[model samples]
Target chain A: MAAQTLLLKGVTKIFNKGTQDEKRALDGIDLAVAEGDFITIIGSNGAGKSTLLNVIAGTYAPDEGQIAVGNQDVTKSPDYSMAHHIARVFQNPTMGTAGGMSIEENLCLAELRGKRRGLSWGVTRARRRRYREVLKVLDLGLEDRLKQAVSLLSGGQRQSLTLLMATLSLPKLLLLDEHTAALDPRTAEKVSHLTNTIVSQNKLTTLMVTHNMNQALCHGNRMIMLHQGRIQMDVQAEEKQKLTVSELIDKFGETLKDETLLSCEPAGAP
Target chain B: MVILSVLPITLQQGLAYALVALGIALTFRVLAFPDLTVDGSFPLGGAVAARLIVEGVDPSLAVAAAVLAGFLAGCLTGVLNTRLKINSLLAGILMMTILYSVNLRIMGRANIQLLFRPTIFTFMENMEVVRYVPVIIFFFIVTVIAKALTDVFLHTEYGMALRATGDNETMIRALGVNTDNATVFGLGMSNALVALSGALVAQDQGFSDVGMGIGMIVAGLASIIIGEAMIKPRTVFRLTLAAVIGSIIYRFIISMGLRLGLAPTDLKMATGFMVILALGIPALKGAREGKIHLRGV
Candidate 1:
């Protein structure tokens, strides 16, 4: 598989522009993710971590600057237009898969993602067997429940399935926006571990947004803290590995204080 | 004696309406799209078919044309919602209202009578079967074909994508399906079936009135609810079948109500009440359990 890189240059997004509610959700941000890079992004409320992921996923076009996935410039692309190369798992487990659809059916939808869906059957016997094989890896006993509706699955199982689905076709970039946040702690950990397994197995380039300080410090090879619509800190390799929870918390607290100061500006202020 | 005669007529009416119920299930259940266009598209089908049939067009060709007309009407509704950014319910209402005028133009009048014209049902009249039995049989065949076709279609890749589009638009969009197209296609297909039902019903009743489709949406919903109540719709085939069976049972219930001294004009009111009761039951049960069932994809 040929590796792919993602590049963002001077990306800016202002929600409710030119209004009293106008907020600079993202401002002049530049980010370059190399091939096989897994980056964790941490931010306090409204810090634009989710916005950054959304912009990259083509959910929102950047008001200024360019976004390139692999060699393709997709700055103005719609969400579905970029989905072939970009897979996403939202914070809600229910957002990742169709609840009313069966397990095998959901997997089939994922497997055929970005591919032309023609007159062929969605879930064939062959594909069902393949899905069973794949579900076994989740260790949630979902293999035997291939025909069951996904709604019947627990949150952890659903999130695990979502993680699996996101990486099923090996997207060029996987965007996870606090995918495990809605689950119980134990389930979250299980999904987190499954995420690590899937990402490494596929050698996928991933951008995960999280609120957990310890999780941000522990999971990815690189970490970035966002405050006031900008990257407050970007830690890599050895710097990220040696970062302790308290140290990360201190940095987060320091930036959060600055964010409050930034938000206190008078009306109509830039 | 009246009950014996009413049984076959009611069966024909019920079976014909099975198509409408199935179409409603497609949008409301499969796509989770609350489309009001069915109300207009139903009569639109009858208007188109009645006009063409009266113009010396082949009955089959007229029916096909009616289906096509309905499909386009549904597509317009979907476009209004997906492209024009109208709320879905409002989009459907807009289409339904516009179709009222369009249906009038199709027939160039408020209603068209097919009494002297040969329709698809005319073939069954020449058979040895009893008058009502032949009509019932004809409708039975049509409903089954529709149900079977839909069952097979739902298992296909495009059908699955359509279902997913309704189940979760955000996820399907992320998965690379153009949900706007899906919405358009789904709504169009849904309305086509409804129009087909209207065409069939108009031919059977010997007249196509612009007001024929009034309250049809609620009637379809009632059929679906009644069908589901009788049998759990766990599979695509089952759901489609349930819609048909529900339509038949709904007819029986209406017939029973009429026999019980309810006026014909009270039918719509009864149907509306039935739907409200069916929809409210689950919510009421959930409330009793101290929970509210919030519905959405």
Candidate 2:
């Protein structure tokens, strides 16, 4: 078996614990992802898909559990500190970058991820050349507009840039929280394609949470279905390849029998 | 004739307070922190400098000490917000209140007079004995240097991180920046600039009054808003330049108001109105364009 890049044991995250509106967003979620494993997660609203990602990314600390990233226990690590091992692309493309800053500045920020940022110039001549090469891959002609503010970019372009930033450091685990959900269909397809190519080229260990059934079935080496904070199905390799999108949809339909599943808002919220 | 005579003094005041404008921009625009600490730290700087100078400390050293004190005052606000989890606005307000007492204690009185005693300006005068550096020229040079430093720092790697914190906290945090450090450090730098300005202004005016810092934040914000209105700055270099130029023009406007028989005591109220006008006009324009609607209108 490949080395484990991430291990979560009895990871439980409760929102508003012990109050009238207490929510067990993530109830004892146990997951282990091997190195270079691309695991796509699909679940209905409030199924803890985003919450689980947040827990692993250290955005929200698991109330009762442990998370080990490549042998380093990170249950207590704050999100900023966890950037050393984890990089993330948010559902909102604007969330992934500083909109007022320039394109090259954003790329420079990603290049220095998990490193000490000192008093040196953020963009050097050599780094600029490297950034140009990287931007050329996005094919958005961003290399020429390196000094333009990121706010000028469309949602899809921003998401694409965010994806590049996320994978730039080749983090131990990359978390995608519906990264392409805000994009138009065509743009979403482009960004999704770029995500797959980048993940495979780098052999990254990625956990992507998506509401799209085809996205789950068509990408990744393993697939997991979450229902009401519990994993209802886990399929991998040959099993994942043989599973059809309709089968996954049926599984989702079976879990939708409960009505209380739609109320949690911004789960794992602080 | 009255307006023309007020020009030189307005220019001097403009240069002196330019640092305050830059400091506010650093916290509010760059770090996205609405730090009311300027109202406190400004006098805190003057008080520290005045007290130290009275004790026969070197003028430059006194200014440096005042800057250091201002930095610590700002860091105190940062700690309250970042570590203690207090709301940022409340944190600044608390620190501003606390500094009032601290400033009073440092001066041993409500005000101090430094009239014929030595100051950095005197030090410059001594240099002028050899090369003729006019006090006005000295103030201009000091503001220019400070503006250059601000522009340079914003382009630096750590500076970018701080700016990003203001622009988007989550994005910078996810890139491994400890945003708490960014905020605390940014506030320190911001207030340090304000303090430096306060120290210099107290020396030039020859007195550091306890009430000197009142409404200073609003003044700084007005300067920034006016500066941006004068020139829509898109780059860091232009942005810092805008603050400096904005302060000069703000001072000019105030001088014009004083010339028009405006009561000096009513300056703060006039400034308050100016800020409202500057901030409200854009929204009003948007409303007129049908982008927004006012129910009462």
Candidate 3:
């Protein structure tokens, strides 16, 4: 009976409206996430998993819907205004951090998120110590190389740092859009483990989109399968624990007998 | 001794142009946009500052007003590109076209002479110091201050977001950074710096001409390309310093070329050729590498 941390009611998004190629990215959809909920989203291509995250992050305006984050109506909020409440880690590791800047500079930026920025002194000793402490927890040895350019880090390290940055401000909602899809298997695994640790430690409300069905089922407390821009199956902690990828596929196959569905098994699905 | 005496003047002019190069670097390098508005904005600053000074305004106040004017010009270009959805290159061209007349209107003619008027540099005359010495010192001080300010600004949270916006707009927007606002702000700041340089240059040269800004973007690009070739600094501070050094080297090259009997009218052609050479050399090297790989295959 905890209050919902995020509420989306009757959300709909249409692209190229009134054109020959008009398409509905999201149909009328409603969803609510309670505090401390970690929800995993799985969908085939063009199923609106990314679009939903985009809408919640204020990148895309919903044609019709109301989005509320902790009692604040943020449906029409501009992207800059939403920084105070939301943070996102993009799929590409390079997209989240500035490669031209040093690791410490990037960390300084994340540390000051949602705060008024001005021409001030560069990173101070106290701030550097804080960044070192935060980076040390990753156990990636990045703490020792704070002055290194972020571009020099491996993909996994960059994504892990991005996750740390996203959670730095403890936003009301954290959006992850296939955040590990671009990393190699070993690196992705490490980043995923770090993500789970951080999300649980912070008790954050999060929605993660994934192409890997096993990851969707194994990582979060809740799993939702999206089809044609709508949620087809939703399972909670116990149910999600019990559900297997094969069973989920069978359920999807039962509803939609398309050959494409049978061939779309996620490569990482066990 | 002749070269030695002219060396400082050339170096001083180069330092002044470094501010121009830094401004262009913000728009062209950081933002990755071909902003032609710098051409108009550069002279616009000089015209506004010169006219204000003639009207008895304080030199500092005139320079500030000139910077503001340049910022507005850049904002106009940004609005055309972002809100009106005009192509970025075209948006800059449109603004440049409009500002030509606007600059003339500001000065009430095609040019203004600051020869007899008291300028900001005149304050140094009150002290018993060598003429070129204080001027050179002033140039160095202003350039260093501007470069330091740029470094500090780019290190902040907002600056990181601004840099990220240029790398990938969609991802920046997804991260709750307003790409449009960043674009507008970045362009405004870039051109403001360029205009400030123009204001200072006008006073230094004793006149402002409507055509002074023509081909400025090309010259600035040359300085940047040359600088990047020499000093490859990954940090903002290093990058700004490289730009300043690059401007000096560019001026030195031009001065050397003139000293070697190159016609003044061919300066634009030489600048254009330098840019082409700078842009082409890397690609040519890359193509050679690809060919080598292909041969090995």
Candidate 4:
């Protein structure tokens, strides 16, 4: 529907290269995501889901391949250098936001991300009022407690704030690395809803890695099942909606040698 | 009479060393860096100021040069850590050791005496006040300016980035902040204040000795502990105020100990013990009261 915002060509990453324990975390892979493409990624553990996201976010450089964001060849860029165009939220709530800083301060810092930080006052009165307005979307009453340190927040609230922070600068690509995995089921559901809202509202090109099969099938316009560092299954909107949990499991069972992956229950299912 | 005699000395020492305490707090608390470079930079400042002033440089300009030298020295430590891939603590130690020889070279000896020179103290001596009053007032004004500048800087956008660099480097780096630059700047600012402190102290005491900065880190920590104990440091301004106030109180305590006949040679040991007691009490209490929960056990 739109121009390609993100592209990966023949990307491969091997951890501990040239060692006895050298493991190929990602194999030759090619992917392209268009503007406003919210793609969900699913795989068993060690299936290169996180590795793929990491390579895209510039946390781990690919052994061979090229990554382009917004038509800019960023294959050689450092993590901080790529941060101008890419925003990422880690799985750990604490990893996403600074615990020592206040909510408003955190948001203010996020606002200046990817921009030249100057000697100007960080949280001006105008910025604080704007933060209050932006935080009202969370409906967590975080606007009322802008001065409270993020450490004082509950896990779900922090994740929400982190998600807010990541999108504050309107990054070209957003990477969510199992961002809801650490939250409780109810909270996870809420965060998932918020994630969907933020992604669609901004029309952001997002790649969300999740272990939940149900979520992979339910959330995004497209679902890619990564198995053994390869795209095993790629399903589009109508086909993805028609796919069920049982069918997805059967498909995984056919190609994967590991039976341990079948035991991963979806959220809220005891 | 005894209190009057000790009061001016206590106040002067407290105010002067408040600069060092503030420097220590910046690296230790703000950046989470255990910078030992201040030890070398402190005396390095005094040596530079004392040497320059003795050679007919304006006392104020000499002090400025001392700050610049200290900033460069701190930046060297930061470069060693960030660019050279050395651990921050070891880099500071390396810088501190190297600065010893540099200080010696600058003064051409182990010490310099400015007994009859026109120093910052002499400039302030023209004021119509009691003998020690002007010096104390000068130190007060300088410390306040330094403290206020720190508070204002920490609120700036670049300052927030620096604070975040200390708070969560990974997160800030991911947000596109050049943390290496922030670290370097933070270390530089920290040591500049420490050097300023040393320059003023040397001028006030009329001498600069290579050994003056020995045991200084411990004294600074002790002052911080005393200040934190007296006033809870919630905000940036309060945190700095605590350090300055703590330095003053620590000086008073040392004076009291000396009045009670504690040997001057045992002063360092006494300060070490006070820090241990101050730091250990809360940790021991936490261990006694904090409950550990295990689910599967």
User: How many angstroms is residue B231 displaced in model 1 relative to the true structure, after the best TM-score fit?
Assistant: 1.7
> Which of the predicted structures, 1 or 4, would earn the higher DockQ when compared with the native?
4
Docking class of 3: acceptable
**3 versus 4: better TM-score goes to:** 4
Better of 3 and 4 by lDDT: 4
Q: Looking at model 2 chain B, which ten-residue stretch has the lowest summed lDDT? A: B288-297
Clashing residue pairs in candidate 1 are none
Better of 1 and 3 by lDDT: 1
Docking class of 4: high
B1-297 per-residue lDDT for model 3 (tens digits): 556656876888999989998988788767777799989999999999999999999999999999999998998898999999999999999999999999999999989999889999888777797777788889999999988888778766677777766655655565556678888999999999999999999999999999999999889988887787787756667678878998999998888888878899999999999988766765687764422110001
Docking class of 2: high
Q: Candidate 3, after superposition: displacement of residue A25 in Å?
A: 2.5
> Which number leads on TM-score?
4
Model 3 alpha-carbon miss at residue A29, Å: 1.2
Per-residue C-alpha lDDT of model 4 across residues B131-174, encoded as one tens digit per residue: 68888887899999999999899899998988888888889988
| Model 2 per-residue lDDT tens digits across residues A1-270 | 999999999999999999999999988888999999999998888889999998887889999989999899999999989999988999999999999899999999998888999999988899889988989999999999999999999999999999998876789889999998889889999999999999999998999998777777788999888887888889999888877755544556567543322232212211
State every prediction's TM-score relative to the real structure.
0.94, 0.94, 0.91, 0.95
